[model samples]
Target: MSALFPTYKRFNLSVKQASGTTVEDTDGNTYLDFGAGIGVCNLGHRHPDVQLALENQLNQYWHVSNLYQQPIQEATAKWLIENSTGDQVFFCNSGTEANESAIKLARKATGKHKIISFKQSFHGRTFGSMAATGQEKIHTGFGPMLESFHYVPFNDRDAVKRAVDGDTAAIMMEMIQGEGGIHMADPDFVQEVAHVCRQNDVLLIIDEVQTGIGRTGKPFAYQHYDISPDIITSAKGLGGGVPIGAMMAKKTLRDAFGPGSHAATFGGNPLAMAAAQAVLKHVFQDDFLHGVTEKGRYLQERLNKSVGDLPVVSSIRGKGLMIGIECTEDVSHKISSLIDKGLLVLNAGPNVIRLLPPLIVSKQEIDVAVQLLSGVLTDEKASIT
Candidate 1:
């Protein structure tokens, strides 16, 4: 009787309420939320600041069709650009839409059609982004995907060099490949990519949809690498819970699109803007981001200790709260075991257990997650024999 499509593997739990780092199911069981709504709830569920901002905006207006210039939209864009260290922003409704806008702007800017994307990288679910996404599974049914998009292995400087030609419009990449098993791009590899882009006069578009908004300890993952992307796409953590997406570009690429070139109906609504403004203001504090670094280290160290002796856990990867644990066994079963034990975790692919705890989550909560995961993995190993 469900009206929704059968595309997603549905979870059985009926979540009724969520607060801080825990979600209460309709059956009245509370579960620790380490997934953080796939990185969207970066500030945790129903944060006071975000809640208050939305409440005030809700009383005022919800949607305005992007005709009259909204002040909140201007404030949000200014906040994002100031934090982003870029020239401008193109607002959208989701990560895929933001990426689509970025790709289109890149192509239009360079006056070329081909885009160079990397293997195992995920851009988005839209046709343009789907074609830009390196994984094949996302493109199975979408017949005749956008042509002129090419993929190369990640971290391969020479392969990227080979892929870029005059017809190539831009090179798109994610700093920490989210769905591609939480792999961090090598710093040297990033520098070389930037060099290639500069030499070829091609744009460098970074997909920060998962790695932005202080998820990776810094305001952005690229900040850690000290590399500048000509254009950047962001979404997941920006709204603190509300839906919002944006594409930021340096001055050159910012001027690519003229007035009528692109648009989104709900791109920068007042309510979403208010929520985003709160997120940027709260997370941009030097003290909060510093705490993120400390908490990230604490969590990672604890996980290393708990899962160290197990042969099944191949590696722990990623930065800050955007961590991934690569297990030797199937990740889905492990995720289910963790969920059964009152800890909510997510599987990035077949073997990577992705953890995107809310930035406000404390060491105490992290300890609970680590202990629960340790117990589940231990029981799983014992049962295997």
Candidate 2:
């Protein structure tokens, strides 16, 4: 009997060990990992730098409550601020908490209540974040959602313009809808949203939980766009596999979140901070992100060549390492076929196959992924040999 809740559609394979882009099942089966723990393991499993940092921090005092004023937290926060528009940051244990914090802070800071989010956009699972999410299915069993959130179609400039009014506190969205089928926000649409926010005194919050921390070949996916967000919520790839989340905002709104306003017990654990510091070092490097961009182009090109014209495929989208292959039909069986062929990938929804390989994954590994996709779509044998 399983003690866990019947929540996730648990995969048959049990991961016993993982390294680089490879995962070994409990029964001694090996698979090339392309999901990267659903885009959390951006540096791949147990990256040497991140692993060493965690090990050293583990030897040190691992968990100290926020009262002690940890300098490691300052160091990590500075990295985020330096690379983005945020002047201050708050840490938490997961994306949900970070976003929840953002919602609270935005309303408190602006002294307004209503928030505008986009349809098909996912923020998180908490009540506040859930209320902000545009998908109706996520709110089905949760009973009446928290009030004062409005949803508009993604990339629809006029809907966003119409949604924002004097009562609206902020506008929250994702640069790429990672959970909503890997849809990228149009650059022009982003500019228009920012303009609307500026004119209406509305805070623009970008949820980077799945698209931040170099997931989109940039420090944050919003960096690719022309405008910057008033606040940013980040996680997933932040700690290189460790659980950590952050909500960053400009200095103008700093006073709103006065002491005792918001807090997380495990927010800045020494070990998670250590992991984040190590991750930031590599991600902020001169050519590290450039490499990811190159690899993304290569991966997309290969996918286009291999299965772009297949009858089952509809389109290939997303940027950086966060590519999605949209199919005309359900892709559950195709994903199972890839897993059987020793290539581990995941589905974004029912019909979109999402690929999020670790930034460190090489062209050869990408080739293996393409071969698996090709073989499965073509119904042929896919062999590493």
How do the predictions measure up, each by TM-score?
Answer: 0.98, 0.98
lDDT (tens digit, per residue) of candidate 1 on 232-330: 999989998888999999887766787889999999988889999999999988899999999999999999999867877889988999899998878
Give every collision pair in model 2.
none
Looking at candidate 1, what is the lDDT of residue 363? 95
Ten-residue segment with the worst summed lDDT in candidate 1? 376-385
Which number leads on lDDT? Answer: 2
TM-score of candidate 2 to 2 decimals: 0.98
Clashes of 1: 0
Each model's lDDT: 0.90, 0.92
- Tens-digit lDDT string for candidate 2 (283-346): 8875999999999999999999999988778899989999999987788988998999899898
